[model samples]
Target: MKIVFALLWLLRLLPMWLIGALAWLLGSLAYALARERRRVGLINLRLCFPDMSLAERKLLIRRNFQHMIRLALEYGVCWWSSAERIRKLVTVKNLHYVTDLRAKGEDVILFYPHFVAFEMGAYRMNQDIPLVSVYSHQKNRELDAQIYKGRQRYDNCYIVSRQESLRSIIKAMRQDHAPFLYLPDQDFGPRDSLFVKFFDTDAATIPGLSRIAKLAKAHVVPVIARRVGNRFELEYYPPWENYPTDDVEADTRRMNAFLEERIREIPDQYFWLHKRFKTRPAGQPRFY
Candidate 1:
């Protein structure tokens, strides 16, 4: 079984388009056969977009499946593609926004949600400015090893484990790094997270960003990478310059709400497969 898995991993390193086609086929098959996830996807969509009719919800669900597959393929291709080739695929804007923050001696925390070209955006950012990034480790040891190799391809990238505390991320910023890039949308277990309202449903959100930003005096910036005209647009939203909130939970909730707004704008670009509303408050059933 391990041998077969390793062989498939090797195939993932093939030319970009070939791997993309394979992932599309695999995703379509999964969407067709995985009744449980498909139902969950549809349910999640309905809850998020209550105004949409049945046909509209179904269309989004199908597109979401294909988007998931394309994203899987993009991961393999982005890691293997050269700088020149990768540049052609993503168009970046607001570079000065990040640079200006760094110039002011402000260590920034870039919050990115799970998007189709997320991995590619991570890679491209490191090429421009080395960042200390935190990545979730895969269960498969072999797959994790390969992923680490791909992440380290550029000059300014570093990975930290979840076991590491907020101080570690602060230290990375103190080293004059670009940004401490991370996604806070996933479930962070029991003690590591708090329930925050995302898209009208309570979702687990990591408070690490708020704590670390307060401790290090770093600025929190929302960054998103979405498909635009067959390429990508990596945009950096300026920090809330006039922010008045000192409360960690309130600030984090506001940041997460901003992410939810972006997701609504481009529903198919976000990762719907993740059980976003996995941990619900008492009396509330799991939404996905």
Candidate 2:
């Protein structure tokens, strides 16, 4: 593990083009060798995009793997690169959506989805504004510690564990008016999850976005991170109006609808490797 981390750190010394080339080579190999993950990615693509032919989905999967590898290798940049380098690497678009709200002493919840460039973009965002995000501990203690350190490397950021109570996360957000970097996608079983329509499939999703916005009295500002050519772009959309309405189910469905629209725009960048529809409603057979 130490050797692997050292190699990733060494990767930071290489040029972006060289790194991308390396990612292409390695990602292609990974796509060919990592059978289970490739299968899962294909299954996910099929579920979400039934109309697309198998060949098109496979091409998308390959591209997704390439992008995933590029982003993973860039973790070293996020952890060790200078603030100036990161600023140049990642461009923040319309950041005032979160900044203006924070300036007014209003808490904001960044409705971040499971984009491949999420961590790298978050690292860049943390350079300017304090962010409070959830942390799920890994089984390996050393790796978990490293991840925790990398996330909070910027001052004034808070990394709360998933094991911690919701009150703790709320308190962290309240402190310094940091925006909660919430990821509302992914399947976490059925508990506290509503089967929402994700890309025309009933995906088990947690309505935490609306619930958290209501609890923290925060504005739900959608943020997306995309890798364009050699650099990353963090696009912040305007906050949703009249969000977290009395209907929780409707709010959750709306969240999924927004995500589906964005995924359609950049199909390969979305995290299709995840088992998004792993948890089905009762009597439905399991996917994956």
Candidate 3:
């Protein structure tokens, strides 16, 4: 771990494009050698894009590994770089959704998913707006401390444990009037989850998008973060209209469908390394 941090510190001194190129090189190696991740990414691509040709899938698999590697390497920048430096690297589009809403004293629920550039965008947002989100403790002690502190470096972020009740998250957001950075697309077993169609496949998804919004009385604004060439782009979409309509299942399905559209825009940036369909219905075969 000491050596890893030292290498990251060294890498942080280099130009971002150079770091990006190095990441691509490393990712190419991983694509060739890391059988399980590559296989999982390919499987995800196949499932999500059944209409694409085999050759197209192969190309996407390679590029997705490259994007995944870039995500890994950029963590150093998010951790160690100054706010001014990061500002130059990250550019936002449609940020008025955040500024405008905050001006009106409205609590916003940032509908963020597990995009590759998520950390960068979150780090940026944390600088100006107080962000409250749920986090699971990292397994590594030193790395955990660094991550926790790094995320709160701006003194404008609050993170609760995943095990905590939603009431606590709601209370914190209401008090701070902070934007809740919610990521509800990923699976968390069957508890508090419902099977929703992601790319037309039944995926175990959190039903909190609508519930949390209703509980917090917040506006739902979808945010998309992506790596375009050397820098990152964070786009804040318009707020959802008439959300949390007393139909959790219908709301979750709509959220998943929106994710499908964004993923289609940049298939590689969407998280594909994980076993997305890991939890199946009682008798269904395991995805892994």
Candidate 4:
């Protein structure tokens, strides 16, 4: 693991175009060799886009693997690169959605999904404003420490452990006025999760976005990041109005619907390697 991190640090010194070419070659090799991951990606695509042909789905999975590798190679850029270099690599759009709220001394929840360039977007956003987000500890202590250091490289950023209670996260947001970078798209098992329609299939999704928003009295601002060739684009949509209504299930469904629309816009950029449908409802067959 130490050697891998050292190699990534060295790779960061290479030109962007060269890094991209390397990503392309390595990504293709990974897609060909990583059978289990490729199978999971295909299963996800088949479940989400049943209307598409097998060849089309396979092509999307191939591109998704390439994007995933590209993101992995850019970890050094996110972890150790200069802020000016990151600013040059990522372009922010409609940033006032969060900034304007912060200016008014209001709490904000950045509704970020599991996009391939998510870390890049978060790093770029952290450059301009402080952020509070959840952190799950990695099993490897060295890897966990490296990720912790990378995430807190900037000043005023707060990372609450996943084991902590909701009150702790809310307190971090209220006290620091940092926008909570919330990622509520993945399946975290059945506990505290509802079977919501992710696309054509039902997915186990947590309603934490709505719950946290209501608890913290924060506005929800949906954000997405995409890789455009070698650079990245971070877009911030307008804040939601009348969110966290009486029905938690409705709010969770609405979140999935919004995610579906964005995934449709850039199908390949969305993360598909994970076993998203791993935890099926009672009596349903396994997806992976």
Candidate 5:
């Protein structure tokens, strides 16, 4: 993994367009080589977009694979490139949502989904403001150190591990007024997770958005990063009104629904290569 990432770091010296083409090529090769993962992506697409024909689903998966590769390759830039270089490659949309909330002395929760250009988005946001981010620990120590240093290199940005107590994260948001860059869409099992419908499939999703917001008195705003022909765009949404309404399950479902809508806009950008429906409800057939 370290060797591969090192190669990506070297690849970062290439022009952005060339980097994108290289990523697409690598992803195409990965799609051909990683059979089981490709199967998982296909299964996910089938379940999510049952209305589409097989040919359409196949096309989407191929494009999705290319985007996924681009994401992996772009991590080199995300980790090592100068902020000014990233500024040149990326642009923001609806940034006033953040400025307005911060000006009002409100803590912000960046409700982001897992998109292919996610690293680019996170790095860009970190530049705009100091971030309080949640991250899961990687198993590889050397690779993890690289990732950790890259993410926390900026000043005063706090990163709390998901394995720790949620109180630490809640406390930071509640008292420190740091913008929590949170991504709660992925499956984390049944523990503290509610079964929510993601594209009509019951996915075990963490309900941290409402839980944290209610505790911190923070405003939740949606953000996403997408690639447009080798360039990146980060979009910020207005805070959800009347959120964390006594219904946690409903709020979780609402998040999934919002992600579903967003995913459709950039179908190939959202994650589909993993077994999204892996941890199924009781009596449900195995999805992968």
Candidate 6:
């Protein structure tokens, strides 16, 4: 299996159409076999986009799988793609925002929701800035090494484990030169998390983002990367008001609210298969 993956990675160097076609075929096969996850994916889509008719939601679901496949293949190329090559693929709209923040001696805490080509955003930023992002290593140790290697391609980009970096992130935030990129939408352990409303449902969101921002006095900048025509378009959203309260819970809620609104803007770009609302509501029956 490891050798097979290596061969697949080597093959990814071919034309994107070949890579995308193979990825779509593989993703389709996985979806067909993954009965439980597919059902959960559909359920998640229906809940999040209740206004969409069944047909519309189903169509979106199909397209979502194709996007996922493309992401899977793109992983191999993310690290190797040169700045010039990458720029050709993504047209960044708000270059001035990032430059302006750095010019003012202010480090940014970029919030990336699970959007189309989300991982690529991290790789691209690492080329231009000091970016440290957190990630959970895969359960398979061998695969985890490969994935981690790919993610840590850039000299300035560090991939810190969730456990080890919890305190370090806060420390780094205080430094004048440290800027962090984070994906704040995943489950944090019960003790480390707060339940917040996302897409009108109670979801578990890591309070780390808010706490780190408040502790480090960093500004939260929301961003989404989506496919435009044949390439990607990255839009840098305006920064949110600084952590208004010392209260971590209140801060978490506000940050989540920002992400929720951003996700709604390009709904299909968000990752729907994830059980974002898995953590049960207070006094509510558990679903999973």
Kindly provide the TM-score of model 3 when superposed on the true structure, using C-alpha atoms: 0.97
Q: In each prediction, how many residue pairs overlap at the backbone (N, C-alpha, C within less than 3 A)? A: 1, 0, 0, 0, 0, 0
Q: Model 3 shows how many backbone clashes?
A: 0
What lDDT tens digits, residue by residue, belong to model 5 across residues 110-219? 99888988888888888887788877778998888888898986765788887777788877665447788898888777788889899888999999999988988889
Q: CA lDDT, every prediction?
A: 0.75, 0.90, 0.86, 0.92, 0.86, 0.71
- Name the TM-score of candidate 5: 0.96
- Alpha-carbon runs more than 4 Å astray in model 6: 173-176
Score candidate 2 by TM-score against the native. 0.98
TM-score between model 1 and native: 0.89
- Model 4, residue pairs in steric clash: none
Candidate 6's error at 221, in angstroms?
Answer: 1.3
Per-residue C-alpha lDDT of model 1 across residues 1-288, encoded as one tens digit per residue: 457445455764676566656666787788888788888777777767788898887777777787777676566456666787677777888877789988888788888888877877877777788788776798988778878888888756767776787777777777875588878777766566888777766777887777777777777777898866346778888786634257877877887788878988898778776666677777876665
Q: What is the lDDT of residue 74 in candidate 1?
A: 68
Model 2 residue runs over 4 Å out of place are none
Which regions of candidate 3 are displaced past 4 Å? Answer: none
- How high is each candidate's TM-score? 0.89, 0.98, 0.97, 0.98, 0.96, 0.89
Higher-scoring candidate on TM-score, 4 or 5? 4
Tens-digit lDDT track for model 2 on 1-288?
Answer: 798789889999898888999999999999999999999999998888899999999999999999899988988888888889999999999999989999999999999998988988898888889999898999998888899888878776898989898889999999999999999799999999999888888989999998888888889999999988888899999999999899999999999999988999899999888888888999999878
Record all residue pairs in model 3 with backbone atoms less than 3 Å apart, i.e. clashing.
none
- Between 1 and 6, whose lDDT is larger? 1
